[model samples]
Target: MEEAKGFVRRVLLLKFKAETAPNHVERLIKDYSNLVNLVESLKTWHMGKDANIKNLHEGFTHVVELTFEDDEGEAAYSAHPAHLEFHERAWPHVKKMVVIDYKPTSFHT
Candidate 1:
């Protein structure tokens, strides 16, 4: 496979625990939306509750899409203190999560 030599993306799928409160879920989404201001390398951000056919989602309830300039931007966002704090706020409510980082070739989502 050829190397991807362009922008990078971080995609996250979240499933909140059954007992988590609704308000906390709301806050989690807000936190994600705010990262653009706190992290300079964050070029774009989009997050929302899963609206797909309920049966298809299994337990995942939220999807977050983040774009970075490059691998360095991705690394910078990962280690940023604000990002760590955000994780703390969301992790308590998250039952399971899937994270994928890749460079988009034909990607024009």
Candidate 2:
């Protein structure tokens, strides 16, 4: 089979503490959306719930997927000030988080 090629996609699953306020989380989401908007190399960004309910252990309250054209693009995203700011503001409220990165084999929808 021919090898597929494209950007690196990062998947982030976050579970916030039960004591986290809804409004604060919503504000953080807005901040993230704004940060994504500023990144030119970020091809696409999507965030929401996981559709499958049966795998509750693997499920998270919020999921964020980000695509970058290459390793350099991803690196730039990692060092961006806005990204750092978002983490500083939101990390304290997060109870747990999981991150996975891979080259996308395909995309639908």
Candidate 3:
């Protein structure tokens, strides 16, 4: 059998302030998605809004998932100028956010 590979996955859960306008959220999504082009370490990026079907989101309404080859790649992306700019523009409107990073693992029995 082929060996399982490992990569870093960064998950960002965002909860916008109750009063944040829809347009701002849209703009943020566009800006966040654009980071993939500017940050070479980003191997993949995806974003979505909570469906609210199970009502388990708590207050986080939006999610951003980013894949990197390793933790160093993620660190480079975090320190990149484009990310800093985006963070400054986006944080004021955000009520709270949770960020988690982990190495994907696969197991077979």
TM-scores of the candidates are 0.88, 0.84, 0.91
- As a whole number from 0 to 100, the lDDT of residue 66 in candidate 3 is 97
Q: Report, for every candidate in turn, its global Cα lDDT versus the true structure.
A: 0.87, 0.81, 0.90
Tens digit per residue, CA lDDT, model 2, 13-97:
9888888898888887778878768887787888986677587755368899898888889899888887888889889989899
Cα lDDT of model 1 by residue, 13-83, tens digit: 98999998889788778877999999999999988777886579888988888999899998999899999
Give Cα distance to truth, residue 73, candidate 1, Å.
0.6
| Candidate 3, 1-109: lDDT as tens digits | 3333657899999999989899989999999999999999999999999998889999999999999877789899989999999999999999999999877766667
Q: Pick by TM-score: which candidate is best?
A: 3
Q: Against the true structure, whose lDDT is highest? A: 3
lDDT value, candidate 2, whole model = 0.81
At residue 49, candidate 3 shows an lDDT of 92
Query: Any runs in candidate 2 off by more than 4 Å, and if so which?
Result: 1-3, 55-59, 106-109
What TM-score does candidate 3 reach? 0.91
In model 1, the Cα lDDT at residue 81 comes to 96
